[model samples]
Target: MGSSSLSRWLRPEVYPLFAAVGVAVGICGFQLVRNICINPEVRVNKEARAAGILENFTEGERYAEHSLRKFVRNRSPEIMPSINGYFTDPK
Candidate 1:
């Protein structure tokens, strides 16, 4: 079909649908980049403060749930051997 015929056949409402989809996709991409780039450092500093016992804790475990895990994951490039020692050695 020619371009004119295809344009005529498509409904006008389709343009709004396409625009909405584009907006949603843009938002999802922005969040993905922010999480990959930004959230890790924020989480690490907050957790590291607590890890240093500079922050208070409630009547529970010293480390917050997932704090240590996220810290290790974010810093593993520099601290992998020391972190691995936690698993490799019993005491």
Candidate 2:
């Protein structure tokens, strides 16, 4: 209604209720923001961890195959380069 009537209604006791409502809203908004902001990072971190584990699993097989090939090459030192040189020699 009138400014004087509104001013009279706005007593000091109303401030605590307004402050409590503001605090509750702030806490709820903070939780929502945290969920929105932090959830993707958690998912990406989990995917990255899974990828790292997969890489380790595959690399173990790769290293075993590489070592086996190296051992075979050491036992027969005249095959790879000889085959390549014969096939690719310009002269």
Model 1 lDDT per residue over 36-90, tens place: 5544333445555465533344412333344656667756465478878888989
Model 1 scores a TM of 0.35
Mind giving the per-residue lDDT tens digits that candidate 2 earns over 1-91? 6999988768897889889999999999987885555433333455565754343556455544665577787565656888888888988
- Estimate the lDDT of model 1: 0.63
Among all windows of ten consecutive residues in candidate 1, which has the lowest summed lDDT?
Answer: 54-63
Native-to-model Cα distance after best TM-score fit, residue 34 in candidate 1, in Å: 0.4
**How do the predictions measure up, each by TM-score?**
0.35, 0.38
